[model samples]
Target: MGFKSKRKIKTNFVSAANKKLRLAWDRKHRQLTVSDWRKWVFSGKTRVNMGGSDSESFYWSDVPGTNRPHQVRPQVQGISDGVMVWGCISGDRPGYSTAIIDGAIDSNKYVEILKTSLMQTLE
Candidate 1:
């Protein structure tokens, strides 16, 4: 409800198949918690607090300087060609490093990374 973001795009949740999947996941989570699938021996709610984070980096190549005249040619800098790297961290565990294809990432590509690298870190 109130968790909706200001920049959110409106969509029909009831008509979305993904909504059913999310609901199923929530149901499983609730079931496991109820059945004590993971026993809480610690006094606090969180014993070893589990967290995950990921980041992306770009590496740019340096361009060589030219001896052309200053007034005749505009100032030129390095080319925009770069490689992107994605990595994640979870407590002491680290996920595998991934290279984004051509500085572009879509839903399918992101899911593949999650399934491989991110999943390993989580496990």
Candidate 2:
């Protein structure tokens, strides 16, 4: 047996429709200049696991190949076991972040985060 211990690759399931939409979006913006891209601020939210990720998993593969179905772990987004935070970055510098101590962010909370973190980042 050629089985070897390896860390499973984490991935999210993307619907066919979403995949097509992503391709279309990519095509639409493929010609964007660096300056055009620089004008945009990238922002996102993520969960910072306190101890470690509960989703960490391992797999065995005899065949040494990349992205085999068995080696790919499908991750489903759910309530985080630790803190959630929002942050952003421009072309030049990283932006401020807001840690969610309470829980999930509602619209009001999102607005407040933007008002404070994002606003401060822009300044």
Q: What do the candidate models score in CA lDDT, each in turn?
A: 0.51, 0.84
Task: Compose the digit string of candidate 1's lDDT tens values, residues 51-74.
Answer: 211223223335445443532323
For TM-score, the strongest prediction is 2
Candidate 1 residue runs with Cα over 4 Å from true position: 1-80
Evaluate model 2: give its lDDT: 0.84
Q: What is the model-wide C-alpha lDDT for candidate 1?
A: 0.51
For each candidate in turn, the TM-score is 0.35, 0.69
* Model 1: residue 66 alpha-carbon error in angstroms: 9.8
Let me know the TM-score candidate 2 reaches against the reference structure.
Answer: 0.69
**Model 2 residue 56 lDDT score:** 59
For candidate 2, the 10 contiguous residues with the lowest summed lDDT are 72-81
The clash numbers for all candidates, in the given order, read 0, 0
Worst 10 residues of 1 by lDDT: 41-50
Candidate 2 lDDT by residue in tens digits, 7-80: 66879899999999999999999999998988788999988876567675577677786788867765546644
